[model samples]
Target: MTTTKERALDAAICLAGSQGIRAMTHARVDAAAGLPKGSTSNHFRTRDALLAGVIARIAEGERADLAPAARGPIHSIDEFVDVFTAVVTTLTGPHADRTRARYALFLELSSDPELQAPLRAQRAAFAELARILLAGLGAKHPDAAVEAFMAFGDGLILHRLTVDPGAPVRRSVAIAVRGCLEA
Candidate 1:
């Protein structure tokens, strides 16, 4: 069973994803979660707290989804593509709403430098993971490859999220990974 905190956080994510960050107030989260008024506020006392919770939740969900690929070092282009495909499909499919919400929150929180720490940490973690994978893939400069791959993935995700939901993201991911690996 989901805890009240988790429910409220989930509701916040869904609300942000579907209706944008402006719709993610505590009262709205409580109503969306079917919890009593002030329930969300009880868990997260401030808007920053709520935004942080949403960011942390998104990271947790992504870590779980990507766990399978983290079991071992990626050994080949095909293996990497398979993992990339799974990730892209999830991001562009079932998790699209939350992903969109994240982007919305990212933009909304940009003016609040203090609220951006978790997002920066998340990006750093992804970059570290990409560095490891790129090294294993024999990229000439793993650090540069990490930056390029992340930029490609982020751009691809953002484009697919906003403009063309039906874009062949998996194929695009494969191409991008192939280019990174071959460069």
Candidate 2:
């Protein structure tokens, strides 16, 4: 069973994705979650607290989704592209709302370093993993490869989310993977 906090956070993500940050209030989250009024506030206590909780929830979900790729060995660029293409597919399909919510939060809280800590840490972990994979793939400069791959993935995600939901994800992944290999 989902805890009250989890339900509230899930609802918050949906609200943030659908209505943007300004509309994601404690009462609204409670209503969305089908919890009693004040339930979300009881867990969060403040807007910053709620935002922090939502960020943590998003990071937790993303980390879980990435765990497999991080653990599995990618012996070739094709395998790497396939793994990340699947990740992008999930992000833009079943998890689209949560992915959108994460992007919305990123925009709203871009200037707040404290609020962005979890995201930054998660990003660092991903970059490290990408770096290792790129090195194994014989990238001349793993650090630069990691940066290019990260940027391309982010751009592709944003484009797919806002411009074309049916955009070819594997093609983008292949481009990023090849660029990383060449970097």
RMSD after CA superposition, every candidate: 1.3, 1.1
Number of the top-ranking candidate, with lDDT as the measure: 2
- TM-score top scorer: 2
Alpha-carbon lDDT of model 2: 0.89
- Writing each residue's lDDT as its tens digit, candidate 2 over 77-121 gives 888888889888888888888899888887888999999888788
At residue 34, give the lDDT of candidate 2.
100
Model 1: lDDT equals 0.86
TM-scores of the models, in the order given = 0.94, 0.96
**Model 1 per-residue lDDT tens digits across residues 33-146:** 999999999999999889999999998988877776787898987888788778877987899878888788778989887887787787787778778987898888787788
lDDT of each: 0.86, 0.89
- Candidate 1 weakest ten by summed lDDT: 169-178
Task: Report the number of clashing residue pairs per model.
Answer: 0, 0
C-alpha lDDT of residue 5 in model 2: 95
Return the TM-score for candidate 1, rounded to 2 decimals.
0.94
